[model samples]
Target: MPTILMRYRAAALLGAAVIIAPLSVAAFSAHNVAAAAPTLSASPNTGGSFAPIVSADKPAVVTVTTVIKAENAGDEEASPFRGNSPFDEQFRQFFQDQGIPMPDQSPEPRQGQRAEALGSGFVVSADGYIVTNNHVIDKASGITVTLDDGTQLPAKLVGADPKNDLAVLKIKPSKPLATVGWGDSDALRVGDQVLAIGNPFGIGTTVTSGIVSARGRDLNSGPYDDFIQIDAPINHGNSGGPLVDAQGKVVGIDTAIYSPNGGSVGVGFAIPSDQARKVVATLMKDGSIEHGFIGVQIQPVTADIADAIGLGQPEGALVAGVNGGTPAAKAGLKAGDVINAFGGSPVKSPRDLSRMVADLSPGTSKSLSVWRTGQSRDVPITIGRNTGDQQ
Candidate 1:
């Protein structure tokens, strides 16, 4: 699979790159009128403060440290350094600058070298159930959860949904632990104030304030790419942290940041709580997630392609190809068919169709509306269980 540049710094890339172009709509001419800018009677922060919210919710957040045994330690293809060495690039550059032909040196085998990674997570239940990013503990030999009071407890992986970069963990706490409730992320609007709590760069818990910069952001991470884009100062170790709203409810889970320097640049992405809540519930019940699949390669319907296909507007998923023996091929779906709707819900883009299809249950029959040869038709398909290989 082609590597996607946008990824969770704490974990591996989830999926391939999906290019979704924004549709531009033309506006009709109307009578022009002057409007006045709205004004507030008082400042926007007249009665707003994040101190109380942070003080109450910080305890539920925890630092997650993962240890990978030496045997499992290896260099990632995307990483410039070899064997996770911090000075690999500097040493090579120094030798090159000195005009010295340095001989190739193999890394010395260490007996018990361990790679440690730090991330953040929040308690979702009082009985020691915690929610964190799947990348945080990926391939970890040992996992530990450190509470706000400096108490550390061994944690076991309950379930992980790599498709959504979410994981559920279980720990045997001496007593009931503090937990945070999920909030309605659908209600969050752009410019709404949000607070981020996490452990950045392995430091202690930190709080930062920012606004919801955008909604439904897709960094081509996975089929489920409905991310809440915020300007919070989340860094490398902030993965799996909670993005709380004014009421101190977990509206989003900090997952990835857009940075070239491996640091926060005021552009961070989070998994919405509504989606996280559904996945967490299933993970708690089932050991893994079973995604619904209808094998077909799809792309966005651009304006030029829409016009060529006689579509008035650029909408729906343009089917580029269909795999054999799959639900789409079995349902007689063709290459040129544009999926306008699935299971009675409209698909505005390829990502929307992908998300809708994956959310369905396997073995269930769904009515798919498609645009074929300048006309529309319905095709019924039996959803199939995704074995983690198909798109």
Candidate 2:
């Protein structure tokens, strides 16, 4: 949806993370300090029956159905054969008079001529809070959630962080809803077992198993795109579903898949839970996140660029451009300056710097370790908020 990346939103097996909070990242009251939500994890040694894990987590997974206006749905199949629809009702008569017998074809269900967009989500709180991809409900006129027990409920959008492609919805269930616990995604290694549960192609809930194919996959979707790559066969309608770990805890949020042929080719991506925890917690309070920003364009410091700049080694982020009146400019940061560190932590790459700056709160002051003119120096700066107005 955002380039060749197919967003597993709507009805296709294609689509489309960093973007992780490090230890130094600010903390939040993500959840109340109470008893942990009951997560029924099955014995990993159970010799191949994931039924227990599925049974425990399935209750928390819900199907997210969204309704978009016809004009924006981009799914009009009026049929060129008809020679009418957008043309005119009068054209239909004219085309009919030509006696062009239409071939026998079953009428396409107006499939939401209102554009019914289907995706998946999971219950994160017993109080009825849900997490899904922003693309799932993007531009939707109405949203509905169907629980595991077949109970349908109208949902309200609590908040959405589109930069992360994550949205939080609130539904009022008659009783406390079943919930899933967050898992540590950082601990997952290649070949570690994981399960993806969701409604692929609007088919009833299904579960697929695979190993962690890779990690830190950046699809160039965005700067905060540190993704968990898995060969779990996620397809359309799996967007926003939870990627569960062996312990039955939610480790990642299924968001996109890699498919050049319009279906899963054993490659899928999910947002790490560590990052989602902070964003979701904030969304639960504020309607959106005020991401930290400093008007500076950056690129990785390749070895050639580093040598030319007289740096000891290829490292840190090189300032390519600095916006005027922005924090970087105000701090006297100029092109050719290499940001080696922030808040005393090494700024290893552009992606690293991106996640670092984004983790800080606006107005929070920090010192940047800058390598300029063959010398290292510290430039103090105040983090600014990216209000979509400022660069």
Candidate 3:
């Protein structure tokens, strides 16, 4: 098997990044205002201690608390037997005739139950823009950010990109807020020293130290599944926290951890800062991102399949199925064909192609290199709006 494809079987990405104990979602609200792109800066840590970096960046890191509405709860109290049906009324009447005391039938003001949850986030701009995971504030009825000084402020959703598992939040503060700058995730190498800071289990802010274990990990969460794998002990409430480097710059966002038990097992996944910076910039400006979609089911070309098709290498994404009336179908991309390159970029695996395609904007036209019938050819195609990212 190809080494790239083997990673999927070796260990699942933590969405393939999983949180054994899921962080609570269900908070909600959107703000009409948008902020400009974030300003980036970093103060390197020279001392052996992580104290300097922490001291510089910790102020920007925050605890995200959310009040989410319970979907199962209702607005008013009603008898359990009083369901929405004529038969339910008859059943209640029957119970009344039997001299049985039924549950309360009188309507009372039963407010929708709200669940409180905690996670972590970091300020990206001095103007009060914050970066966190989409899952952190997903479905929240209200959101709050607690600063390091213990000041709490209301937060509003600016925009969210679930495919990337990221969201942007806005808070109007009285003054400029402390901010952590973005670092180059592409520069991160395996074994590089790093720090994971967050409010694990909602017990205030905590910091963990580790190295970048791996890069370009596909958790299989979605099309844009590339993540940085780390050995830091990121836990439940660390969901949207920042993964910093010795340079004191934000390099990744702690998202999920792989554990059979509900704790960190030395396996954690983070959204690369390079990716997050782009998404955050777009969200702050446009309020959302529209991923490009091509309607096709794909799988990595295994060695066996490669040999069968006389392909010298098991690389690129193999077309498994194509949805009709979609971009792939319209481009005459057929089953059994292999997509070796997309928009001039080499496709090393299905994951690579997925990430590449999703990075494209809808209505953008690009050339796709296809291998078919013992030959290769380039095909022109236009990207389509992703009504859904499944394509």
Candidate 4:
């Protein structure tokens, strides 16, 4: 899994951050614009006031506070003031001269300190089923959920799937709780209006509105990288918050953001609600998810590699290696074979194949289309339960 950087940006600033990679922006001419008017008009709202939607969805959003025990608190880096830097003494003297309190010069380690973190979550069911990011309550000794009405209640972790960065929690509410319904994230399109509700920077429920900046974004975070990119200002403490559509349906879960500094850069990523719903359901039932596995190392077929392999287009996943005694090996899958399709679904890239394979049920048989020695052929393989050891 790739490291996801968490940052926050204010909701008021909507400027696009400079991405290192060049993004293709489509340009429309006057004639094309006129031709697309009808289609554009028929499409969902690309821009509008999300006040009504936010008002309805805000109540379901809750603030998640986690307390990690001292034993679980990770090591902290040495501070500059604690080191023997020449400026350290001067800094202390300057503070004293300016009538400011002197900084703590204690050499005590923080191993005894209990760490606390704040994030956001939303009620998914009236019975107090909540959805949040796994990282939010990771290694937490205690969890608490604060409702919109200022009611705080202890929560228990029902299940967590770190691979998907999602967790399901159960709370005993006094009564039926406000809940949000999941929407079909597949129906989302770029430029569609979205509302992000979360407790950013530990502040109370904050609602930010923006458009779906992009879709099917893969930030190299995990095997399931189908993230919905939104310009909605989500910052630190917003993780696990719901990204609601214009109709107040939960379309995605705010997870990570791209930022050079520790703030949002108008580029935030969310786990699509459609994918999350399945995980949440499984977690609620089994308390964990078991991913299907086919033992094979794969890589994306680059244009140069594709040409060399006689493939006209850069597509599918190229098998780099095969694990012995595994399903792929038993099924006659070999290195250099390009997997074009799995279970009748076209594999667009290595990540696509990874996600498809992981979603399969273990011990199930599936047909795979492979390109080998300049020809395509179908091979049947039985999916195996992931042992949590394979990369």
Better of 3 and 4 by TM-score: 3
Candidate 3 runs further than 4 Å off: 1-43, 72-112
Cα displacement (angstroms), candidate 3, residue 362, comes to 1.8
Q: Best candidate per TM-score, number? A: 2
Cα-lDDT of candidate 2: 0.71
The true-versus-predicted C-alpha distance at residue 391 of model 3, in Å, is 2.8
Each candidate's clash count: 0, 14, 12, 3
Give the distance in Å from residue 15's predicted Cα in candidate 4 to where it truly belongs.
26
Give a tens-digit lDDT track for model 4, residues 79-173.
11332321235435544666655444323225666555667888766667778887677677888888888788899999888778788887888
lDDT (Cα atoms) of all candidates against the true structure:
0.70, 0.71, 0.70, 0.69
Lowest summed lDDT across 10 adjacent residues in model 2 is found at 16-25
Which candidate ranks first by lDDT, i.e. highest?
Answer: 2
Pick by lDDT: 1 or 2, better one: 2
Clashing pairs in 1: none
CA RMSD of each candidate after superposition: 13.2, 11.1, 14.3, 13.5
Tell me how far the alpha carbon of residue 134 in candidate 4 is from the true structure, in angstroms, after superposition: 0.4
Candidate 4 error regions (>4 Å): 1-48, 75-109, 303-313, 389-391
Q: What tens digits encode model 2's per-residue C-alpha lDDT throughout 150-241?
A: 78899999988867778888898887777877788889998999999887766577899999999997655456778898998786678788
